[model samples]
Target chain A: MNAEDAGANLAREADESHGRTVAAERRALVQALILVLLTLWTFRDEVTKSVAQASTMTQAAHGLALPALAVMLLYCRRAELSRDLQKGSWWGAVLIILAVLAYAVTTWPFYVSYVRKLQFVTAFAGIALVVGGWRILWRCGPLLVLTGLAMPIGWNTYSTLSIRPETLTMDTALKALNLLPDMVVRLQGTELHYVHAGVQGVVGLGDAHNGLAAPLALASVYVFVTFSRVRPAWQSAILLIVAIPVVALGNLLRVLLHACLTVWSGAMPAEGLPRDVALVLSLVATYLVVAAASIVLDHLFVEEGGDSRVATTIRR
Target chain B: MESKDIVRTGAIRRLCSPIFGTTALILLVAAVALDPAMTALDIHFRKTSILPRVSLSAFDAATLPSFKSAPKESPFLDPHPDDDAGTRDHVLQRLQERDANGTDGQVILFVTYYSDPNDQVPHTPEVCYRQIGGVVRAIGSRTVELGQGDWPKRVEVRTVIVEQELANAAIAYVFCANGRFYTRRNEVRLALGWPGDKRVYFSKIEAVSRFERDEQPDLAMARACKLLSEVLPALLTRHFPRQADLKHRAVGAAR
Candidate 1:
């Protein structure tokens, strides 16, 4: 064969190989599309059913609120591609598959345990998918955590935070109030009475829930308001840290105020400014104060780069 | 295909299935791990005027459903427009109205009529109290006011001399405010001091729970026993009159 002819033949073969590669890629694209569509359609019922079930766990006011926030966040960030988009993990798929097994077990409706198992599996797997597996697809881990809000599953503040030194806080609050000026302050027999007054409240019962949601929420707002103008990351991280206790402290204050009022007034809490009204008023006040405090904090602490800590680190 | 395309191709579909799938699994595991806590609260089957009228419970499922599926407000619970709001500001105001400025030893038995909302039968108790020196305030807890002041308050407790014949049936409920529910620590009287013989079910309260238990065929005891309890009320009342009714005919003879 002539040299020119040989070169022409080689070029043709190269073209053929390139065409084959493109064809193979087209096939892969079609398959992936089909897989995505089918997965959503097939599991659509389960996804919705799971979310619906989760929504029930939240208080009536907040049942749908979390999901709404999730959607709004995505809308706000639509311009940016998420980091953890669609890398399928075996762990994630295993979760839904358990439902299939759970569903089979549930065939015997007479078996109460199996029914409960079905419910539990559905909730647990669905949540893990959203939190952990979804994290595989997203940049924001905090938002992923927020998804748990779909079901406002909460535990008693005491149960969750009991190990965090409630006794010390109670003593501090009482000491600040000048409640124990004379008698030695000691928690006895799991119950403490103001031996002088014979009035008893659990010394270590420093929980955020016992009708102090408003105050706690307010205190949290204070921390955030105190630090708002700080850099987004710093503000978020600091506010996040500050929010829980701000709310807890706010709650403690409300409780202390109520206990004091009850002892002094000799009237029922429901009667004095009324418990319900006090709760509402305190909640509103807390929001206002927290917002004001955050603004003040932002002005006082937020420097050029971020908050004082971030600035100080940069300075070094 | 390029690597980015490869990641994108499988990504979104891979994302949703497992995230939700696993969350559900974990929640299920947690639910399984948690012990079932069934509390008997809510008033439906039997009649008792002592409890507050708010029947639409925020708590769901496990407690028995109000026997009537159709929502009708109880006449008792319906807030009275005619009632003075200023007078109603305090729980004590309501308490005083209930007590009618009384004096001396009297007791009121607040018993649990039905607790399980899933209970098929029509027995719902406002609160459950066993009559052996026992007074149930709501459910899972009860309090007897020994009156304000001093150590080792002398609270009125019912003591039984004989079964079925109530010696201290005449009583009134003590007014308690703002519930404080704590975790059952060693504080829940974890001590197994004695056999539960001193405890006896209140006659009326027992009747309600029995009615509920009987509805479930599996739990139904074919044979039932009469409610046998005794009490020592702080104050005596005319409503649950002492030795007036023939039901207590056994009182003098048994003595």
Candidate 2:
């Protein structure tokens, strides 16, 4: 063949090869979708119970949004997933079997309420491994962790763990509220007594007020860490480490806002639309703070790249 | 066929291979179906092993000699609200007494009976007090001696002092699960959840007394403890399920 003819033939072959890889990736994704659906269907009851708890319990309300956030995180990485898709391994089947058996034991012989909820996450991971292989599982690790965190903290567990944070939140809120001119806020135990403009009211900082902000803040941090492409596990660790005080500050802000509204209105709206709105606003503020910190970190630590000036100078 | 058609057909055939596709579907279906089947099995297990207990409604609070049933209105104390009716039975009472010091001592008695094995550990004074805007200052367990002929000669009860903005409360409570007394919440959970004897039941008897700034918690604690000792024996004998009945049920299920 002439040179022109040979070149055209080679280009045609490359097109065919590219077509085959794309087709294979598409098929694998469809299969993975089917597996995910099956896993979710199987664990529908647990998910429903979790959703109900998240809706009613203030401490777990953030759980209602986590699943959707996880899906969004996965969606953001679609390009990476499509590029790295491959045939799965038999080990995924082993994981699926182990998770199913553990779920059965928890369900029939002994009812471990919390552990049974966790099996939903394990089954999802196993499904991901089965359909998209190890690379996909690695890529989707943060989303999986997010899904696990989405499970509602059981009432017993929340009651046990919330005491210290609750006390700290109350104390910080009291301090902040007192800073307002013409507002004298006093905390006696969990109740906050406020006086402003000759108006007096008492806001009882119950379970509803104390625990929701921290978990909501932590969930928001994970969302940021997942979406912002924060690198080097240590950086993510720092973000997580700073999240505690951020959560405390957010909770203090929520209490101060709620207490102010209660004092001004001459009624204690401890739990209702006003309190919920204040909580959502505080969470929004928390997210903005976290986003600003993440951006600062991004600027402070630059990732070394092949085209970087420093790398180019070293090569020269 | 053209080469392109051949490649497309080959890909479809590989993707839809019957053996591999069928096995994957079967495995997933089995995993999906496992929970409901096992939950059915659990229902069967619960049906056979559940013990019969006298309902809390049958226990008349007025029958006690030293205490009379007063109105259930307390500023600092309220019953822990539970939405799931099927899981537990709750009764709240305000008991009143005129102490020897001429001070009218009032105690709020809250009792709950749980039979559902899936139910979590019952809320304790530590959690309940906090829910009502009270901070728990101190919590510990104390042994209270019951009168003669009581099934348990001595019982350990959790004692907590809670401080609210408007008032302060001294509280004491104990859990009777599987015919034994327990002070801690986890102990009660373990006893009720033990698979050895599946006849699971637990009752929490809690008493709270509100004291002012002038009075110490000792007075409030003494009043609560006094009420607990007077009422605990009656509940064990008259209200709770007997150990003999549980064994009989087990034997019948075994047969």
Per-model TM-score versus the true fold: 0.33, 0.73
Q: Per-model C-alpha lDDT, please?
A: 0.33, 0.70
- Docking model 2 quality class: acceptable
**A114-192: candidate 2 lDDT, tens digit per residue:** 7878887777777677767788888777777777777776666666667667776777778878888898877665678
* True-structure lDDT of candidate 2: 0.70
TM-score chain B for all models: 0.17, 0.72
Summarize candidate 2's per-residue lDDT along B191-216 as a digit string, tens digits. 65556564777778888888985678
Clashing pairs in 2: none
Compute the DockQ of candidate 2: 0.27
Q: Kindly provide the TM-score of model 2 when superposed on the true structure, using C-alpha atoms.
A: 0.73
Look at candidate 2 and tell me the lDDT of residue A172. 74
Query: Which digits, one per residue and each the tens of the lDDT, describe model 1 over residues A1-316?
Result: 9999999999999999877655433433343344333333433433455556545532213334544554455444432323233334455445545654454333221223323333433433333343334553333333344433332223332222322233344445556545544323333211123423564333322222233234323432343244323234565566667666666665556545554554455544234343344345555666665666555555655454466675553233
Chain A TM-scores, per candidate, are 0.43, 0.82
